[model samples]
Target: MVALMCAEAVILGTNSKDYQIYSLGDRIFCCAPSTGIERGIMLEISNQVECQYRERGIKPTMDQVRDMLARKYENVSSENVLLVGQDRHGPHIYAMKGIGIPQTLIYAAKGKGRDDIIGYLMHNWKKSLNLAQAEQLVRTCLLVGENDYVNMCVIYKEKETWAKAVPQLEPVAIMAYDTESAFDDMTSMGSNLSN
Candidate 1:
């Protein structure tokens, strides 16, 4: 009997305090986020890819590298990896899981709060969000979430990607008030939360 393995892909980004965003050229952007054992796996994969690119002086297509890693990880039952990159043509997002064989994750895959987050993003996300806007979406997800599993996040494109440590947000001093009044209250309390 073949035992099937399942895993969830974690898409996280850092808090606003310290964020690392990179730009390679004019089009390519990249960000990688992994945790648990997959952290080491991701590092190894990234190092190998960088080494190869250095030697060849040419970057391989994201699909090619992804398929190669999937093959390498086919033996693992549960693995989570999220790699976001874009080329001149457009963006390429890869959310992968190592089941019986490593398979790419689609938008429909459900794992805990994954569905809710995906739904939130689907409604808020657009093709036209600039780099800052994109980063905001990621930050908002991590900042507003109740989940502890996500401690990091990566937001990347073909030219630049940002990775940062996402610190948990403290409970807000919520109060009943008008919208404008609430905004001012929150703004004042926001600085205290960071302290």
Candidate 2:
């Protein structure tokens, strides 16, 4: 799993099976080792979270979500979970280990190929990245080979809030280029993820 905050959006990506990413209100939730039980737990939590925000207009804090997960951790099969969202305080990334307290992060990756993904992000991520650049970065980092597919979610606020999840059935073709060239291409194509 990979979760990062870009200039105007939070991006989450994973190559895991069984639909590991979900939307909770305005937030994007991602978990690793997705199983039937974990999916069920996530569904329950998402409903509760959406209700809290919809009925009371109160967004649940990362800590609150973590506490909720802790209460149900014993039955879940997930080992790592990431939550990304924005609030009055701005964008936030929360990384949780099992039922542990959520750790605030600017970017996070877990499960298989985590080290490689983290290293790539550490060397490549920039604060100025737009939605296209961030999405491409995630796609590049997640490309293990010629046959891997990626599931991605982009969470951004326009007038209200929006979350888009795209599941790629075909393998993403990897390209080699410097950051400057990639940025130029993205700009020329006007490749906004929201579009």
lDDT of 1 at 36: 49
lDDT (C-alpha, whole model) for all candidates? 0.45, 0.74
My TM-score estimates for the predictions, one after another, are: 0.51, 0.69
User: Top model by TM-score, which number?
Assistant: 2
| Candidate 2 lDDT, 19-98, residue by residue in tens | 47766555546554466666677788888988998899988865576567667675443456777766545577877765
Tens digits of lDDT, candidate 1, 73-189: 676654334444444433445555555243443222223345555666778766566555655565565544454332333334332323435667999997776989888899989
All models, RMSD in angstroms: 20.2, 19.7
